[model samples]
Target: MKIKNQIKLSILTMPENVPLARVTVAAFASQLEFNLDELEDIKVAVSEAVTNCLVHGYSNDRNRTVNIVCSIYDNTLEIIVEDEGVGITDVSKALQPAFSTDPERMGLGFTFMQSFMDNLEVRSEISKGTRVTMTKRPQQDLAAAASEEN
Candidate 1:
C-alpha cells in the first residue's frame, strides 16, 4: 500500500502523553471525515496502545520514549505505537482476552484495538521492544462525504 502522507512523533512515556497521542491521531484521522463515534473509537484505540506501551512496555518507567507514526493513504489511516522497553515473550497470549502479565491490568488493550480498527499487527521481542500497527479504512459513506466536502 502506498502512503499519501505520514507524521511521526516521539514522546516520553509519561501517562499524560496518552491523551496527546490520541488527540493528535484523531486530528489526522479527521481528514477522512469520520463521525464523532468513529473519531472517539480512534482516540480510544490510541489511548489503549499508548497505555500499553507505558504500563507493560516501560513498566511505568516514565523515562523511556514512545514513538507514534500516523500514515494516510487513499481511504485508510494507519497508526503505529512503539516503545523500547521490556518486550512481550508471547504475543499470542497477550492478544487473548483478559490476559495480562500484570495482575492489575484487565488485558483488553489489544482487544479494543482490534475491535476499533480494521486491522491490527503487533511485533515484539524479549528485551527489545514492541510495535503496534493499526489500520482503519473509512466506510464508503464517510469517504464519499469527505470527497464531497472537498
Candidate 2:
C-alpha cells in the first residue's frame, strides 16, 4: 500500500508524553478503515514502544527526547518510535519474552508490540539509540470496502 499521509513528532522523555504519542498515532490511523479494536491495538503498541524509550532507553531521564513518526498507507499504518539513549546490546535477547534489562520491569514491551501489530522491527546500536518500527494492517477486506464506498 502506498502512503497517504504521515506525521512526525518529537517530545521530551517524560512519562506524560506516552499518552500523547498513543493518542496522536490512533488519531492518524483513524483515517484508514481500521475498526475500534484495531485502533486500540495500535494505541497499545505505541504506548509500549514509547514507554520503553523513557524507562529503558533514557533511564527515566526526562531531559532526553523521543521521536515518533506515523504514516498511513491505504489500509495499513506504520509507526516508528525512536530514542537517542543507551541502545540495546542484544537485540535478539531483547525480543525474547520476559527479557528485560531492568529487573524491576517485566520486559514484555516487544511481546506486546509483536502481538498487537502485524510487523515489528527493531534496530539499535550500543550507546547510540534504538528505533522500533511497527506496521498494522486492518483485517477488513479492502476490495469490499472500496466497492461499498463507491
Candidate 3:
C-alpha cells in the first residue's frame, strides 16, 4: 500500500504529554480500519508509555521535553517516545507487571505495549534518555493479496 502521510509531534515532559499521546495515536489510527478494540488498545498502550516518560523518566520534571515522533510508512505505523532522563538500568525485569520504581506505579507499560502493538522496542542510556518505539501495521487484507497474486 502507498503511504499517504506521516505526522510527528514533540511534547514536553509534562503530565500534559498524556493527552498529547492520546490525540496523536487517535490521529494515526483514524487512517486505518481499526475497530473499538484496536483503538482502545493503542490508546492505553501509548498513554502508559508517555506517562512513564513524563513521570519516571523525567521524575515529574516538566522542564525536560519528551520527544514523541510518529511516522506512518508503507502499511506500518511507528511511534517513538523519548525522554532525556535516567535510563532504565534493567530491561528484562522492567517489562514485568509488578516491576516499578515508584510505589504507585504498576510497571506494566511495556507489557501493555506488547499486548497492543505488533512490535515494541525500548532503548535507553543511563544519562542519555529512554526511547520506546512501537510499530503497528494495518491488518493484512488477505482477499486483496490473493486477488493481486492471481
Candidate 4:
C-alpha cells in the first residue's frame, strides 16, 4: 500500500496520557472518510492498546514511555502501540478474552482491539517488551469495491 500520511508519538506511561494518545490517533485517522461510529471504534481500540501499555506493561510506572505510530494507506489506517517495559510471557494466553494478569481488571483490552480493528497482531517477549499492530479499513463504497481488481 502506498503511504498517504503518518504520525509518530512518544508519551509518558501515565494513566492520564491514555486519552491523549487515543484522541491524537483518532484525529489522524479522521483524515480518511471514516464514519462517526468507525471513528469511535478506532478511538476505543487505541485507548485499549495505550491502557495496556500503562497498566500492564509499565505497571503504572510514570517514568516509563509508550510509543504510538499511526499511518494512513490508500484505504486503511494502521496503528502500532509499543512499550519498553516488562513484556508479556504468554501472548496467546494474553489474547484470550477475559485473561488478565491483574485480578481486578476485566482483561478485555486485546478483545476490544481485535473486534474494532480489521487486523490485529501482537508481538512480545518476556523481557523485551510488546508491540501491538492494528489496522482498519474504511467502509467500502459499493462502486469502489466493484471496481477494485481482486
Candidate 5:
C-alpha cells in the first residue's frame, strides 16, 4: 500500500531468518521505548509471518525473496511481510487460529500475532504469494480509556 516507514530485509527463507527478523524489529521498535512485552510480541509475530513464507509460501522451492516492511503510525506499529511463492488456497483455514499447513507448526503464529497486536490482516493469491500485515496499537487499558472519556 505504498508504505513509507518500513525496512526490507532479504535473506534465505530458513529458520535463522526468524531471529534476524526479531533482532531487526527490536532495533527499530526499541527507539520508541517499547516495553519488554511489546518487543517480544513484535519479534515473535514477525518471525511467524516470515516463517510462513519459507515454509508454506515456498513449499516447492526457496528461490524467491521475502520482503518485510515495518511501519509506525497512529500510535501503532505495523509490520508487512510479503513473499512471492505459492499463495494460500484457503484464506479462511489459513487464518483460523491453530491452523497450520505444516505439522510441526502450532499454527499459533497468527494467533500469537493477533494476541499480541491490536490487529492482523492476511492477503494471498493463488500464485502471487502472501502478504501479512501485523499491527500493534499501543494505548491505555480499557479502564484508562474510559476515564479519559469521562
Candidate 6:
C-alpha cells in the first residue's frame, strides 16, 4: 500500500528514550482513529522494540543511536526501530519466549511485538546491528467511513 505519511527520528540509546520512542510512534499512529486500548497496545509494542535496542543492542550505552521510522497507510501503520550496536548472534534464539542473553531480562520483547502487531520482522547481523519492523492494521468503522468519504 502507498504510504500517506511518515516520520523518522534518531535518539540516543538512553534508558529514558524508550518512552519517548513509543509515545511518539503512538501519537503518529493516532491518525488511524484507534481506540484507547488499541493505542495502548501499539505503545506497548513500540516500548518493547525500543527497549530491546537499548538493553540488548546498545547495552545501555548512551552514545549509540536508535532510529525510529513510522509510516501511515490507508489501512495500516508501520513502525521500524533500529540500532547500530552489537547485533544478535542468533535471531531465532532471540525470538524464543524465555531466551535472553542478559540474566535480568525476561526475553519477551519479540513475543509482545508479535502478539500486538499484524506483522513483525527482525533482522540482525552480529557486530553490525538489528532492525525491527512491525505493522498494525486499524479496526475502526472503515466501511462507513469509506462510504461517507465517497
36-128: candidate 2 lDDT, tens digit per residue: 998999999999999999998898999999999999876678999999989999999999999997898898989999999999999999899
Over 4 Å off in model 3, which ranges? 1-4, 140-150
Which structure among the candidates has the greatest lDDT?
2
- Worst 10-residue stretch by lDDT in candidate 3? 137-146
Worst 10 residues of 6 by lDDT: 137-146
Candidate 2 Cα outliers beyond 4 Å, as residue runs: 142-150
The Cα local distance difference test for each model comes to 0.91, 0.91, 0.79, 0.91, 0.78, 0.88
TM-score head-to-head 3 vs 5, winner: 3
Candidate 4 structure quality by residue, lDDT tens digits, 53-73: 888888899989899999998
Clashing residue pairs, candidate 2?
Answer: none
lDDT of 6 by residue, 1-150 (tens): 898999999999888888888888989999887888889999999999888888888878788899999998876899999988899899988899988888888888899999988899999998899999999877665556778899
- Residue-by-residue lDDT tens digits, candidate 5, 1-150: 443356667777777667988799778766554678878888888877888888888873556678877876645578888999989999889879888878887888888878887788989999998998887754444346689899
TM-score of 2: 0.91
Summarize candidate 3's per-residue lDDT along 40-129 as a digit string, tens digits.
888887898888887888888888887777777665777888888889999777887778988887777788899899999989899788
Clashing pairs in 1: none
Checking candidate 6 for backbone clashes, the offending pairs are none
Per-candidate RMSD, Å: 3.7, 3.2, 2.7, 1.8, 2.8, 3.2
Q: Kindly indicate the candidate among 1 and 2 with the higher lDDT.
A: 2
Task: Output the better candidate (2/5) by lDDT.
Answer: 2
Error of 6 at 147 (Å): 14
User: Model 1, residue 97: what's the lDDT?
Assistant: 91
